[model samples]
Target: KRMLAFVAHKPMKIPGQFRKIFYEDFAVHRDLLDKIFWNLVEDSTVRSLNDQLDQVKAPTLIIWGRHDQLIDVSCVDVLENGIANAESVIFENVGHVPMIENPKATAERHLEFLAKN
Candidate 1:
């Protein structure tokens, strides 16, 4: 259920065919998932990176979903403001995985960013 929510703009947007795939993926990766979760939970590097964000000199594009359940859209500002060369594009009515939920728009944004950068 959480996987579906993360991939889709909404739970109902999840295709019926992909439900079984997600279930199987979870079953196969449950142990790995637990390890990753615990590792990140214990890692202080995640928070410490904030102090270094301004050091990033490369152009950065932050494309986020307004409806992202896992990470709120408001956090985009942190990236945009912290990075030296950063911009953001917010996709409304979308969720965490914009590449999957709205591939066309994601690709378009990427193309635009590439052309500009």
Candidate 2:
């Protein structure tokens, strides 16, 4: 609950029904989550993919939350500049998980991008 609040721009907006599922999922995946965290800390080489962004040839749609707490929105600039074929959309007043924050808008953007590409 605390971590969710930290990551979400408006945690209170999260549906009550989904909260239980979220908690259960987290509890089940706790070990996997710990492993992933440790791996990220230990593997310095996997820290950033910025250097390899130029190698991406496929059409890329970068969706980000303007108020993301985990990763600052400024990184979107880096992605746009780095990727040759990249389109980005920043969701205003959204946090780390924009899909959960605003699913309709997020899905619309995804569908639009998919339709074009």
Candidate 3:
């Protein structure tokens, strides 16, 4: 049931039916992630980012998994509030990388968001 829902997720892509594997595959590089993401994990860094977020005028779409374990979901709310023209959609049962766990839905949401602006 869970797998079917994932497979049914929104976006329909032309070339990469196997694209879901990419996010899962990419996550394997834990060392690199820690090296890069740690800088943004700090409160000062995240808060500082809000200032820049305010300056961004592009239409933005934020897709977050409510159950994400790696990064706190609260950050999504922060980003949503900071960015002026941003929309957020949360997948309640998903985690940090919903793209991997639920590629279809992720793809659908991404395409839908992209089409609007």
Candidate 4:
């Protein structure tokens, strides 16, 4: 149950039949996950993006999940305040991956951002 909950916003929401397939995919992609960790997580620059946010000149749309446990929602303020032209829209019931938890709304917000920009 704990492992299932780790990948999903609410593990109860996931159909039981799909759970097996999800875990199977994780096993198959374990190597890729390890590579991502070494390439991104272990990289020092990724930890200090705040200092470089000011370098971003393009119009930025910061979409975050208010319930995200992986990355705190408070970081949105850092990006919004640091970036020259930035906007944000947070999803209340969503978790770490907004696109997976609420694809329709996420895609709609993305389209709206593109249209406005």
Residue 65 in model 2: shift from native, Å?
Answer: 0.8
What is residue 11's positional error in candidate 1, in angstroms?
Answer: 2.9
Q: Give me the candidate number with maximum lDDT.
A: 2
Give one digit per residue, the lDDT tens place, for model 4 in 7-105: 446645667678778978899999999899788766756577788899999999999988877778999999999999999999988777888878899
Q: Count the backbone clashes (under 3 Å) in each candidate.
A: 0, 0, 7, 0
Worst 10 residues of 2 by lDDT: 40-49
Per-residue accuracy of model 3 over 1-117 as CA lDDT, tens digit each: 343444433323534546567656766986798877776677665577667788878988998887766567798988999888999999867876678767799999999988888
Q: Can you give the lDDT of residue 111 in candidate 4?
A: 99
Per-residue CA lDDT of model 1 for 1-117, tens digit only, reads: 766666567655657788788888888999999999888877755577667798899999999999888878888998899997899999988898888778899999999999999
Ranking by lDDT: 2, 1, 4, 3
Return the TM-score for each candidate structure.
0.79, 0.87, 0.64, 0.79
lDDT of each: 0.85, 0.89, 0.74, 0.84
Model 2, runs deviating above 4 Å:
13-17, 44-47
Q: Candidate 2 at 15: error in angstroms?
A: 5.3
Question: In candidate 3, which residue pairs get closer than 3 Å at backbone N, Cα or C atoms, i.e. clash?
Answer: 9-104, 9-105, 10-104, 10-105, 10-108, 11-107, 11-108
Tens digits of per-residue lDDT, candidate 2, 19-94, equal 7888889899999999998887777476567887899988999999988999899999999999988999999989
For residue 97, what is the lDDT in candidate 4? 80
List the pairs of residues colliding in candidate 4: none
| All candidates: CA RMSD (Å) | 2.5, 1.9, 7.0, 2.5
lDDT of 3 at 33: 81
lDDT of candidate 3? 0.74
